[model samples]
Target: MKLLPCVYLSAKQDPTSKQNLSAAMKAGAQCHGLWVANYGNQQTNLRPWNRDQIEPANPVPCKVLIHQYAGDIANGLFDFNQINPFLENPELVIKRLILPPA
Candidate 1:
């Protein structure tokens, strides 16, 4: 199955974060394997590290990931606002999603 990567930033760091995460996991997004990027530090943290400390994992299904992404997108919780323009025009976002990665 295809896989996609998505993220959501809490608006006020509230308890809803856990609920949102649980919902994503229940929807089959493999929540345990999240990769958090601390943009302030320019660092990325991956969970479930091995003894050798390597990043080895596969992304969850694209459908599941995209569903979670859309949820956050609708809630305006993403790290970037550049997508706001496309919020009302999902056709553009769908095109971007289908494009090959650079």
Candidate 2:
């Protein structure tokens, strides 16, 4: 199954960002997309825009919506010390896996 890049959006700074990213990737997430919504923050511009911003321009191919931003599955994977945490949550993770990029 092909997986899309993991996306992140946060108002506050997170110190565990890398750990979370690593956890997600290790859990089988393919890409890493970042979208910061800070007003007038140029640093936020450096990262890729969220799906909403790009959907109009370039749409994503997928049936279900993945909520990796909430850290719901990633956190559970890290907490459980699972090497392939994404596999553990097949119902939640794989169900959201999108089609391969064209």
lDDT of 1 by residue, 1-102 (tens): 112333433222345654656567677755312222222211122222221222112222221112111113344544422222213554545565576777
Q: Candidate 1: which pairs clash?
A: none
Candidate 1 lands at a TM-score of 0.26
| Candidate 1 CA-lDDT value | 0.33
- Residue 91 C-alpha lDDT in model 2: 46
| RMSD to the hidden true structure, all candidates | 13.4, 14.8
Best model number under lDDT: 2
lDDT (0 to 1) per candidate:
0.33, 0.34
lDDT of 2 at 32: 28
Cα-based TM-score, every candidate: 0.26, 0.28
